[model samples]
Target: MNTLMVMGYGNSIAMSQILVVVVEILLLVKIGEPLECKRKEIVTNTPVISSNCYRECEYPSKPTVCEYEFNVVLHQTMSAHCGDCPFKKEDCNLEKCVPVDGSSRPLIAVNGSLPGPSIVVCEGDTIRVKVTNNLQSGAGVTMHWHGIHQTNTNWMDGVPRATQCAVARGSSFVYEFIAEPAGTHWWHSHAGYQRASGAFGPLIVRKSRKTEFNSNTYDFDLPEHTMTLTDWADMTSLDIALKVNIPALNPRSQTVTILMNGKGERIEFFDETGQIFKTPRQMFEVEAGKKYKIRLIGAFIAACMTSFHIEKHSMTIISTEGGEIIPYETDYLTIAQGERYDFVLHANAVPSAYCIYASGYGNSSCPSNATFILKYKSSPLNNPTCASYAVVPASQDRDQYMGNRSKGMFSAIDFVSSDPGDQELYRVDLRHYITLRSYAIYKHPKDPGYLNGFLAVDNVIYTPPLLPFVTNEPDDSDICQSTLNKTFYYTCGMKQCVCTNILKIKLGKVVEIVFLNTDEDIIQHPMHMHGGSFRLLGLGSFHTKKMTLDNVIQLDKEGGLLRNSPVKAALKDTVMVPSNGYAILRMKAENPGYWFFHCHTMNHGERGMVIVLQFGEPSEMPKPPLDFPRCEGWEPK
Candidate 1:
């Protein structure tokens, strides 16, 4: 068998492959015989240490008192199968799966549940989070608090290997920081492909008292219901990675059917048999003439641009990504993966149920899904049935209703722009090109590329690179060593080529990203970033000048450019880049820590369309404790 080893600095070098094999042998001897002996062998040979030693042992101690105090925790658990399964009964056994912590289970989870937990707080509040690792085996775990501004607290930003070592099995760590510039955000696991398993939750920060009142509102009521949409894959995260990146194991295409918190099996509604079965897909109800804000979070792995319509009533977008925006009325609003949109709908027409549907953007062939009825009561209007009503498309024209006088009325308060004097634009310190490649089941000469017809970035098919930045945290020596081997190379010279460039941004800097889609693949990619949102500056094919500002602009379609001509304005987080096209985006690096930038499409991210953004100065960042037990033999040379 192939052996994997880790060599320590000098004294007491222990090989990981040998240790694992020895432990496995011991386990085999005690299996079905003596339970105590098996337990002893496992504990003595394969000990589980407090992986959080670095976090707990850090020096200079955390501040005794801070601006705010928040408490949160992270726990690990097992799931039998993927949450997005139509058959719901196919639980991927946690016991037989590999990868130690049972993380290889078809649906192992962080915090013991799907959609994790909701973290709600006001702006400026100091928060403290305590994460507890509870899986059977050691599993690397990290958390990126989507858009919160915790400058210089990069180490505390949970990212396995990059920010610090993985939280050891049955260990805990405290993440403390202050929340700034409130907005709708999320948190997810940074470990290898774990986020796909279901390790994410909502991070909503309420607006400050001043900002809340200034927007001309009285009582601010939360949504009657909050819906998080996500796509589930049936295979284990590791298996998915192997199938996508490995050159000899080509797999079939996967599809998702269940929609959480929508008209799906998750909801328990009464059926004709008087038994509670899964609720059927339906429309949502809202009161006519009354204002209601719907918080839509696209937790799916793909990019989705949702459209809402209620016959004649128009919709107003009040907030996005948790930040307040100038209230503007429109027919439809687009949201992408890891993106959130909070819009207020004024139920002015006849009281009835409105159809709220989310359509998949890009080259998605998946059919759109619908939600339950939005009942508009408190009026003498009759409820319209589905047969008599027709669903209207979200209006794109902003000038039709408000007229030319309100053209730039709310432009000033729309989005936060960096001040020229305080603008800190840093040069692109680290540039890494990314690509996507597929591998077929066996090494066949006639196979188009790695996987049947898969392409590659540069010369090699893409594989997720080890996140060295977060992994080699605290220790300058190890960090420097990893950085020295930064430039990556792979082998993919057979078929098409599709690569992406990743830039490391400094905290508190304005970054301009230019994307050149070299027409390697025919499908478009919806590129998304965490933390701050970017404005679409320009977009066009390789032949012409860039087009106008659009959140989602289709790349070189067979029929001219697919532009949202009506809503030519800045968007919150998601944007689609056409195939073989070019696009540019401008954003501010307000939040510190390691953030993820990746393609919204699940298949693409799995095939290496993802990168990391390490914000903030290295000097100001905190270091892990000195007493932290190093990985068995992972010391610097």
Candidate 2:
């Protein structure tokens, strides 16, 4: 590993003790394809100590042991720059979107921007933000730092009713935590359907944590080249939530409109007064023959998936869900709702403007498309031979370090010398061979046939709690728990089956989950996990009947299940269970807290298909903030 030097700070301490730092400088002497290796840390800085890490891998075979290091550094408090993390929800007017249809809809904006504001920071920088709910009188709001491993501060997971209650309406909530594993991530309101109202934005963390890092990824990483694609509705999110289950509002037939940066190439932007201004299409400009890093985020609350593609450019996928992945080249990539992807774009093409297109999928209703431009500035109309290096754009600037083609792409990622974890059969601790088919808690029949109102886990339904489990009080009760008497089914408002069902998991146990997408639903399910990421063990073939736990366990015993990848790399939080097939996933319950696992489709999770995985002893977890906001009255609207 390359030696890294930390400087600039006058004090001995770093950011904060709880800060997340990727200490990538570890020397490992490999023997015969990773036969054996040891890791030792030499602390060179004061005001720092180590803690137990949640990233632990206990392999029973050729063990894939990871260096467990939780270095804490003390320093002055940190604050987000006003320019990056802009304001209170009510005070900002971040977005003014007018789609092609010329509709004036209300959206949750930040600093007056539609897609909210981008929180850009470096690897080790801690973040602090104050979010105020300025919506209706009693409307509640809570922000979930999507794809971020909250690490030691699991209470700051921002999951209402689980980690902490929602920040009540007309209230303010402060979120402070460390951000790690630099790449692309986003934040959105976890309260009700608020995210659908535009309560979401990009959060980027860059800079290598290692002293020596790979550069040849891209020539220039223009932070300004950030954009978002989402499914937009003219009606309020609450209204949509109320009517979504109705036959008239059947999602199957209601194609939605797609927008980029909250703006589409619709009727030129005209205000309520019938005035028009330049409705600029989302665009990115780059120097001719230059390589650029572009971050793409999906914040679709209604749509299930969106396929993104550029007219004349191929994207090199370098990172996924805030973690660097095996850099792979592809023409197009499908981004499900709530997922982020970062790719390098090489403007090697002759100087020209190219169309960046995105279309939402999985929904026959509300179909939408967003188009933007990737214009190369100052390209010779005709191919010129003699080129002048003449001080082209900034390069080698640490900020522009998102560079180069990596030769060891396979080393740390897929091209690894060896992976001991793959040698042993899957033995994840949850013990239960869980098999779930995607279904619905219908507004009418047991099987509504189409994705209309509420979606539920075919095996069970989960209801978000009114009170958080992260409080000082012990959680000795949950609706899903079997009572001493007969199995009790609880109901809240109009639903007889809605109740909180928490899936308790032991810490450091290997577990496997097989999701079977039933044919009852016409769409695929993009399942996602919060607080913890899983290894995609395998994707099975389409099955007509839902396999029981016994059957899956039998298949594993018989070596019928597909194992690890042979060529490509795998580490992801979201995986799509085919419309009539299944996806098997494995993971170690390392993090100790209430972790949410659900389908990424916002509407699907809001209604059902949301399950909580409780790791470790609840009492051992960190306590909620002293002034933690209570969401007792903030029930589903």
Best candidate, lDDT? 2
lDDT of 1 by residue, 1-637 (tens): 9965566674234665567889998778665232112222133433222211111111222211111111123333232223422223233222321111222234444434556656655555455556666655457566667666455555555645445667766666667665555666777766666666666776665554444522443233453345566654445556655555553445656444334432232334354587653323333555555666666677666433333343455556666665455566655444446667666666676655554544443335332443334556553433333332212222322111111223221221133322222223333333222332233434764455445334333333333324434334333322211123333332233343333323446665666565555534545556766545565544544423433212123433243433221123344465555455555565666665565566756566556565556566555345546554334345688
Candidate 2: stretches off by over 4 Å: 1-102, 209-214, 248-255, 268-278, 366-368, 379-427, 437-453, 472-476, 481-497, 540-557, 565-569, 625-637
lDDT of candidate 1 vs native?
A: 0.47
Q: How close is candidate 2 to the true structure, as a TM-score?
A: 0.71
TM-score of each: 0.61, 0.71
| Tens digits of per-residue lDDT for model 2, 1-637 | 9954556775346543214242222222221112112333445532122221112212221111122111111111102211111123221122232232334555555444556666665555556566766665466677888877887777788777788866665566667777665667888778777677777777776664332122477876556787778877656666776566544434432335677776554444345687554334566788877788888887777645566667667888776665455567766566667667778898887777777777655545645556667777874332122222211122311111112233111111221111234432354444444334444445454354644645555355677665777764434555464122123421222343555666666676677776755434556667878887666656644345555545656877898866665223355677766555567677777778888888877667877777777777777677766776554554676
- The superposed Cα distance between candidate 1 and the true structure at residue 551, in angstroms, equals 23
The local distance difference test score of model 2 is: 0.58
lDDT by candidate, in order shown: 0.47, 0.58
Local error of candidate 2 at residue 93 (angstroms): 11
